[model samples]
Target: MHEQESTRLGDEIVRLVRMGARFRGMFKTGDLGAEFSALMLLPPLRAMGPMRVTDLAEFKQADPSTVSRQAAQLVKAGLARREADPADGRASRLAVTEAGVQACERVREARAAMLERALADWPAERITAFTDLFEEFNHAVEALLRTDPTTPPREPA
Candidate 1:
């Protein structure tokens, strides 16, 4: 891509990202502060199944103390619980509770509602095309990570 085109792409992505962040903050009305931590589950929990608090901190780019406390709050709220990792006696792992699963499902519903509202008139093929392009873009990003593992990951769009 030409320099100007690359700049425009980045600018557009940044605008979308800022919009997404604001929307999340504004529309998370159903969630108590406790339920807000539910958003933190998808990445770490999805990839590693049950992960240690230290691992969750690294995966979520959060401080260990904060993750530890939040994990405790999740436990108290019955959203997630800690387990003894039998393979590693010293490490504790976290898994989402049934209530946490329900919360995740609620998040999915909200996401679907947002998409439906945004694309009320969008053609089905356009949605498919968007999915394809996004997957290709995701592949390119994974390639970049493989090429430069030390490069910090960009903020999501």
Candidate 2:
């Protein structure tokens, strides 16, 4: 890619990221009646099965204590529960509860509805092409994160 094209691409990506951050806050409509920040832990716990706070922190590249507190909130909200780790009786793993799964689905539905409306004017072919390209882009980014010494693992999109 030309230098100018590369710069433009970077700028556009940054703009989209900022917009995504904004959209993140817009979904907090009390669908789950829990703190939005705490609920942020649901998806990972759901996807990862059961995990320790330390493991969650490592995967998120965040502080262990912070993740522990967040997980505690999830437990308090009944979104997640603590399960005894079979390998370590002293340690507990966090697992998403049925309520958490339902909440996750509701949130996803809202997000998908919003995205559908946002792209309502786009042609079907354009949408299909964008989906394919976006998936490829995300895979390339994940590959770079795995191989690049300076790149860090991030939560999936």
Candidate 3:
């Protein structure tokens, strides 16, 4: 890409990220009583099954203490539970509860509804093409971060 085109794309990406954060804040304050940070832990636990806090921290690229605190909130909210780790009887792992699964479903529905409303006027073909390209872009970014040793680690959005 030309320097000008690259700069424009980068600016657009940043704007998109800011808009997403604003949307998340609105959702967090509207119907999802849980803190966004704590809610974020659910997807990983759901996807990976039970995992130790340390493992989750590594997977999220966050500090273990932050993950532990989030896990505590989730536990207190009855969204997640602690279970004995079969691999290490002395340690415990966190697992998402049925309620947590339901919460995840609700979040997914809300996000979809928001997107549908926002794009209601867009042509179906355009929406489909955008979705495909967006997924590809995200995958490219993840691959770059994974393979590039010189890339600096940054906090998750």
Residue-level lDDT of model 1, residues 35-129, one tens digit each, is 45545664457446888887787766566777777788778777788899888988789988777777666776777788788898999999999
Better model by lDDT, 1 or 2? 2
Q: Name the candidate that leads on TM-score.
A: 3
State residue 116's C-alpha deviation in candidate 3, in Å. Answer: 0.7
Q: List the residue pairs that clash in candidate 3.
A: none
Compose the digit string of candidate 2's lDDT tens values, residues 38-154. 677778888888998888887766677778788888788888899999999999999999998988877877788778888999999999999999999988976787789987544
- C-alpha-based local distance difference test score of model 3: 0.84
Model 2: clashing residue pairs? none
Q: Cα lDDT of all candidates, in order?
A: 0.73, 0.81, 0.84
lDDT of 2 at 150: 88
Clashing pairs in 1: none
- RMSD value for candidate 2: 2.9
- lDDT score for residue 4 of model 3: 100
Q: What is the lDDT of residue 111 in candidate 1?
A: 73
Arrange candidates, best TM-score first: 3, 2, 1
Segments of candidate 1 deviating more than 4 angstroms: 26-29, 32-38, 42-48, 57-70, 153-157
